[model samples]
Target chain A: MKILIFIFLFLIGPLTFGQEALNIIFQPKFETENLVINKTYLFKTDTLKINSFKCYITNLKYYKNDSLVHVSRKRAHLIDATDSSTYYISEHKFFRFDELRFNIGVDSLTNVSGVYEGDLDPSKGMYWTWQSGYINFKLDGTSSRCPGRKNKFYWHIGGYLPPFNTLRKVSLKLNKSHPRQIYIQLNKLFEEIDVSEVYNVMSPSDKAIRISNKLQLLFKQVP
Target chain B: MKKTKLLFTLSIFALLSFDIIKNTYFFNPPQYFPQPTYDFQKNPLDSNKIELGRLLFYDPLLSANNSVSCASCHSPFNAFAHTDHDLSHGIFDSIGNRNAPALFNLAWQKSFMWDGAVNHLDMQALAPITHPSEMGSTINDVIEKLNASEEYKTLFFIAFQDSIINTSKILKSLSQFQLTLVSASAKYDQVMLGKDVFSDQEKNGHQLFKKNCAICHTEPLFSNFKFETNALPVDPSLNDLGRYSITQNPEDKNKFKVPSLRNLSYTYPYMHDGRFATLKEAIDHYTSNIENSDRLSPALKLPIKLTSNEKVDLIAFLLTLNDKEFVFNKKHQFKKISIETKE
Candidate 1:
């Protein structure tokens, strides 16, 4: 009986400690090397500065050893594109997180009409309040190759209804057993998206759909 | 050991039963209606939170200058809608574009506003709160003020189990309180349930309403809640393209969500732009004043030819729709504690 107890303890110890974890970072690579923060335009755009860019990675789930496990939602929250101090995740229950998976735009269920707040809040500069939809991926900046000389490019993409629904699903595998960071290249997203088509996507329309489709293809799994 | 196990089991059982009773007592619904659109699971309705919402609804503190509350335009006495004015007056006596809609049975409404611009009732308050001519305050600013108020902090803690006065909690509690404003005790409801009889004139009017307007204004809720053009000419001054403003589709131009007739007596100056002041005027519009348009509802294609007597009968039928029980319910009234504190 004592030997059996010893065997059970030994097996449980490895089960608890053998799990692996990974930290996934969604890095936005700008077309130009330099990016402008709130007021100041800086020369370094390759490195994502905290508090400068706001994007949501919502409804994150972990798929390990086949079965699906739900991770704490607020754990994966808003990231700043300017300040490094503000760049880290606060709720770290998944500190030993082995894999990372999440969707960019809101899930189809939330896309339907109802009350929403936080990243889903209509006033958070992420949603188009007037249109009753979310801007799935917002790429706002000034470009010289468009009309009005200083063009403001806003990709307000999302709608569940026909002719305007722009929901995109992105899936990636961590590949390595204990990967530390996952990198996303935003420059590739713009390469596929014609600055001309996206330049005019001011609302939820066919253009928004085209841009979202193109942007999804640009998200690559890095080593 | 047996006695100790029994005690532990009893305590757990007590806590479990307490939770069950709590849920049942909190989620009582009116038998007449279907389930509410709001998923209480996301934001559970607590008595404290509901009370907090009630206070917020009546509090003028939500406004930028603290001069007007939602009740200013939508008073409880008038079934949460203002009287004597076709248009709603906002902060600094500035008039809004449309009339203030009566507030009640909101849980049943999938969309809000005369134009249906706001799809969710949770986000409904933000429109009036942010409109430059309306309250002129951001939700975040309103939250900041609520957070600073010691009284509000305690109330939020009670209602949400958390003292954080964020926009979500504010909007959720407000909606929970509004959802509880179910108006089902109207004279029409009694007549429908066969508990009471309508006057002969009211009965004839009811028949006329069924024949003429029932296609759009369906019974029980008194509204199909669908958008209809109704064939009325656009007010030249307002030029409001109701649903089209939200949809941006030319087909939805001039289409407005059908207003519920549960409290038609108190909620006067009907239609989206408050075009008709009286039931007779509205009946006349449906009869003789329907403008020819591509988006006109099929039911209203043929002009309704109602005699003066028929118009009076329609008015008599409309009077039965008034739910006096809802208007006078003390639970739906202003928070006495805050009012007393202020006094």
Candidate 2:
């Protein structure tokens, strides 16, 4: 009889446990040492890690706002991170008001489905072909001052689909302010990225772990 | 150790019982059809998932600007095919190059789309969702939209036991709803089962179909469902080369999916381009201007000489293939949720 009770409890236990849900707000930011929109930057260090940086923000509101509208019931919009061309500071619509959110690598899911359009669309180039998963977030551009080439650097970070599934969720708390904005430093993320092999991540490899850890550090509280 | 062993054995037994009961209770294939081509072992059927897919199919949120839906073209009243249009129209009033085919009995289909671009039903929605001129949205966008809806969350939880909607769940649910569109209760099916006999005119039409059309239309399901070019002239304006666009093989230029003859009474203006609006016009094209092309089916080496009386008989036989019950079934219609006006 005891064995039967144990079996029943074990069978039903996992299903009964409710998951913890949290309300998270993302902010975006951009900084420059010798900044120009079209030009690239380079670092002398062999490795670069954007450990603690900020995701800046503007025109943000809770419940609702004019320019910063939430997608009905959902709280997300395409930052149009494709390029600064369509989403540059001078687009005149205050388009550079960045809001950062990420799935980054993988979440806990068993099966993968096919072609998703939107922020997850292939037009964004955030999809993985080898294992079939979305990268959730991508931070890629050229860094010229880096030691790799005369003026060349790359940061392609994403992986999700077992064994190498490396997406992480983050939470941020902010004090009472009209708008929320935060910064993420590239110091640690650049440091953690592999310099031994030019530290490029194409698929789910050791590179996924390096980039995932570096990305998690970017999410911190706003005072 | 003994307690652990006993618990493990009981859990396994319960799992086995659940599988057996669910498989037996949920699924019921028609008596006459062969084993479905879809491997159900990969994705199990669920009542809730089917319900969720039905909701999504009719929801405009699946489009780029939330303007179009799967039902925009493949309406329930039209047997899942668009009516009164030769080519399917999409977002911003953009015209797609091909007609929207009727969607049903997908479990038996080995491939999807008129061109067979996607090999599995699981991967089929990706084509229309991203086809620019079609739904003009991506599966990811659709998932995000679904995730936002409280009603969809409830629907998703009911279907997959969790409200965390993803691409897999969305695709599987859509597949479930489409897979259930089995049109097996037509008058032709009744005649086959000896429940009803065809009228003398229908019987004559049946014999004629067997002679000229049966080699392609086949029997029972009324489709061989193979790619065959039935010698059609190219429309200069559209310049669309059916299956060749996907395969890029010269041999496949004019070929298209040989559509099922079932539901012909409802699925009018046939062919990939929907050029012919009536069955008589379609039959006449086949008999008259069967343009000789390299990819034309060997069966059409010579023109099919069908007299006017024979055309009437052939159409008579085709009309009996309509499955009205499958069309008006409330299970596949729009959800009763009041459309929320955009703020």
Candidate 3:
């Protein structure tokens, strides 16, 4: 009985302490295969090609039974299509979590505060230079359906002021037993709007706000 | 124990020396001035950072073709305001819409630019840097160039402890230099400080200014820094709707920020578009040419009826506001930076 008790104590000690990393993979797919920059894809019989895609993700948090369990130390993350390590979040040890919560863009308070470093820096190509604001979500591409010079289409969405604030919060329930992976599906995003009509969104306007609200639907925790 | 004691004495000396250096570059505005709005805690002034900012300010490499710089329009000799040219000339002889305003006493300004578009001083440089007709360059390209340069690499490492050139450090360094541009040594300031007395003509002009212009262009700072319509007829070609373009409010149409009266002698031609070439013309517009429009500020509805004599006296008082010491300050002048073209 003494030997059994010693074995039990050793097994339980390993479970209680240390750190864990969560892989929040943002997978942008073009139909079946993964999305590649400047690669042509069939868009319901129309030819489509994406040149650039980027967005800011912030306010990462985790919850268990509606109680806050973890929060991210990173102020903001600029998730560029070319950079795979941008969205992966590593957190301190937590026993259990039922919900995955985060924002699709930087908050209004952070926007007006001033400048930033690292991923939030203006040199990241996500910040607007003329007026003060960050380009919260950017998607530039070329499609046969798009009507423009060289068949180009760009949607640079961002705003912090009221009536046009584009920041979005996404809270998704998780199965405690499975690995955490957030998938951002491009096919679902394409279905939401026609690329021809809503192509040029470069500033803070009603269209930018509407598209930002629609972005919450693009993220999910399921397979 | 003797070695430890010696180390402690050396550390104390180092701290004292650093304190003196910091004070030299410190944002020390006059006691009469209001508290500065800049959050110094965010980016504290360091001698190295200010020097880096000065270098960046004069570097033509900031422009797209490496031909124009911030000093191209905001020359130091004219109180950092471009003289002769009413409309600012940008890269490749491209003309900008508005006159480049003088840069001084910026620490007290709550917002920047003629339309108050920029909420912070740190972000103000972005406008000129990226404007197509101005610098015609993007912030990313500028940083890439700076990162590639050997001179900037060394300067940046000295300014910021780490050598990584980022936007936060860049803007913070620029603000540190600009915040030190305190124009508080004018003859007007001397009179206020009781060191000197105003001339009889200036004394009368001071009284006239108090009665007519005091409401909008307030004292000490010389501007209330609020948006007000002075009722200038819109140019048919430009039709610039000043503050309304930023806010999109009907009430703000044709309303530009009330400029500071200090350095009025240096910053010209006056108004948002540099329409008036002389002080007399600017004053005359207020007294006689104000359009009877509802958009006009209540003070401008009556627009002070200054006699020709009063106008002369007011000009005398305005000239006293110029601080010659500031415009000629060697510290603010250009120190040429040599750069290697990124291979």
Residue A7 Cα positional deviation in candidate 1, in Å, after optimal superposition: 15
On the 0 to 100 scale, the lDDT of residue B167 in model 1 is: 72
Better of 1 and 2 by lDDT: 1
Q: What is the lDDT of residue A116 in candidate 2?
A: 42
lDDT head-to-head 2 vs 3, winner: 3
DockQ of each: 0.38, 0.06, 0.66
Residue range B1-343, candidate 3, lDDT tens digits: 6776576446535644674365434677777888888777787787777878998888888899999998998888888888777888888889988878889888878788889888788988888889988999988888899999877886776667567887887788888788878888899999989999999999999999999998998888889889999998888778889988777678889999988878777788899899999999999988888887878898877758888999999999988899988888898988765533233
Best by DockQ: 3
Residue A130 shift from truth in candidate 2, angstroms: 18
Tens digits of lDDT, candidate 2, B62-102:
88998998899899888899878889989999998777888
Candidate 3 residues A60-165, lDDT tens each? 8878999998787777877888876765766645456788788888898887777888888887888877777888989899889889889898889898887678
Residue B236 C-alpha lDDT in model 1: 82
Interface RMSD of 2: 6.8
The runs of at least 3 residues in candidate 1 whose Cα sits more than 4 Å from the true structure, single-residue gaps closed, are A1-20, A31-52, A59-79, A82-102, A113-123, A144-153, A173-182, A188-202, B1-35, B41-44, B336-343
Judge candidate 2 at residue B54 and give its lDDT.
83
**How displaced is residue B39 in candidate 2, in Å?**
1.4
The residue-by-residue lDDT of candidate 1 on B1-343, one tens digit each, is: 6776576446545534544334336455446666667666676665665677788889999889998888888888888887667888999889987889899878778878887767677778877888767788787789889888867875665455577777778888888778778788888878767899999999999999999989988876778889999887778888888888767788999888898887887878887777788877877788888877778988888878899998999989988989899898888788654311121
lDDT of 2 by residue, A74-112 (tens): 222233322322221211122222243333343434114
lDDT of 1 at A40: 27
DockQ ranking, best first: 3, 1, 2
Clashing residue pairs in candidate 3 (N, C-alpha, C atoms within 3 angstroms): none
